[model samples]
Target: MNIQLNQLIPIPLKEKILQGSSDIWNNNVVISKGDYLKIVAPSGTGKTTLTHILWKLRTDYTGEVQYDGCNINGINAQVMASFRQQKLSVIFQDLRLFGHLTAIENIELSRIKSATPGVGAHEVLEMAETLGVSHILNQKANTCSYGEQQRVAIIRSLVQPFEILVMDEPFSHLDENNTLKAAGLIEKVCKQNNAGFVLMDLDEDSYFEYTHSLKL
Candidate 1:
């Protein structure tokens, strides 16, 4: 499960933009197996940029992101998309979902489209039940409460057979109670799947109980 970043894809920056810049991420950052890594930073601190670089979306950057000793920058878009679909899952703070689809339908969509095995409608329903969203499964995503939609989004991530879960400020919209519940669900899913997680957030305290922290 070793993840490495290698090679370099130079990104040109205007002189004005680099006027006072002294720090740049040019080297590889290795994330070990079964580790829960936290990337903490304030808003606009390049956390999302780093995530995109690692996930092979921002290939114009000055470095390459490798996973399990292979440089992914050389891979094609379809390969990268397949990797993202099967082995890597992302949960955004906005909780991206289809407005017309039901909570269960959202999860089921991921299962149906995924190349990984062991995920289906039954599994999606079970995950939703575990996250306390069984009652809202049939409800449209746009009609559900924010907290419920958040849980649904998380369950969608769980339904994928991802070895690495990259979450960007997933708990920002939840109340105190739902935050705890979501954290618990995240921990349960990660442990059950033996998956490593990369959580990006400014509030490290909220995730302290679920995973170790690493400030970037």
Candidate 2:
């Protein structure tokens, strides 16, 4: 599904954002299906806030956000839930995993929630192995290190079926090698599904061959 943003400026950051220039805030922009879009945002620039808004985790913002030409504000909770379960997936910066669940369990939760059939358990294992997190699949999420948790979260997001992926600083805890591995896996998944992604990061990198780049 294509995502359209029209004059979207967070109320909490309005004054500061209005005083500056941005390629996203208060601008008309379209993230079409299968497009790889990168948003470079520095600290205190509402980067996380923007991610939340797009995922419908927050609505305390001005203007409109549309999915496939339908205004998100007009969508009921049931429809929104359907969209999230089938059309959208996200890799949050904070890695919102169930602390009490095992790494594989966390991944399993997402796999079972998809409206479309998700990857099989064997495929999940293959993904974990690719990202070098297979060894920790049985470990509790809270017991894993930050990097391990991040890898688990990435696996969780990928197991689900989605048309568009939204990621926020998804590789902050990894080294160059792991980052590339994770990026490769993400790209492969998106390609296989003919999907798109919106990634917001503090700095720029050659992680993916981005179709568009915007400053926020």
Candidate 3:
């Protein structure tokens, strides 16, 4: 599977929100399966916006993006939903965990039992433990700290079937150690499935030893 950014540039932004030119917005690109892509941009340069567009969460932009040959702009809601559930999983910047549910329940919600090549409860718990959140598994998501919630969201993303795993500043809440732990788990899972891993961050840190880097 591959995602093609065919002149896939967002519309122009005002000088206030963004200044100067951006390479991503001025070029076409392609990211294939198993590719590790790091999109590094400064704040207010639309890092989240690019991630949303790649995840098909927004369309208030210019150009066409083809996901494995299916034009993203043409897909209906049902198809898009299925695509998201089965082929793409995202760790949104907001974390988006269910506030009322316990951490384990929140992670389990991402599971589709009938979906083959999917992660199991064992793996979910394994990841939670790996990220140092196993002790909080019984706590409600809303009650957990932001860092804890971030780990919960990471585990949740792993429980689903996906060909491309997208992350939007998933490590923003973690320190260097936690970031390494989380990134390690993510890389392990992505390698096992040969899935593409795309992350958008504000700085060009030596994050993940990212195989490719794009500036926005």
Candidate that would win on lDDT: 2
Q: Write the per-residue lDDT of candidate 1 for residues 1-216, one digit (tens) a residue.
A: 556754333364323224433122444466664778877767755666666777666767665577766778677788777777777888877778998999888888877675555366676767777668899999999999988998898888877777788888887777777777777777777787788888888866655454556554
lDDT by residue for model 2 over 1-216, one digit each (tens)?
899999999999999989999999999999887999999999989889999999888999999999989989899999998888888889999999999999999999899985565577899999999999989999999999999999999999999888999999999999999999999999999998899999999999999999999999
Taken over the whole model, the C-alpha lDDT of each candidate is 0.72, 0.93, 0.83
Q: How does candidate 1 fare on TM-score? A: 0.81
Instruction: Kindly report the root-mean-square deviation of model 2 from the true structure over all alpha carbons.
Output: 0.9
Q: Which ten residues in a row have the lowest lDDT in candidate 2?
A: 112-121
C-alpha RMSD of each candidate structure in angstroms: 3.4, 0.9, 2.0
- Candidates in descending TM-score order: 2, 3, 1
Model 2 residue runs over 4 Å out of place are none
Pick out the ten consecutive residues of candidate 3 with the lowest summed lDDT. 12-21
Q: Quick one: best TM-score, which candidate?
A: 2
TM-score for each prediction? Answer: 0.81, 0.98, 0.92
For model 2 the TM-score comes to: 0.98
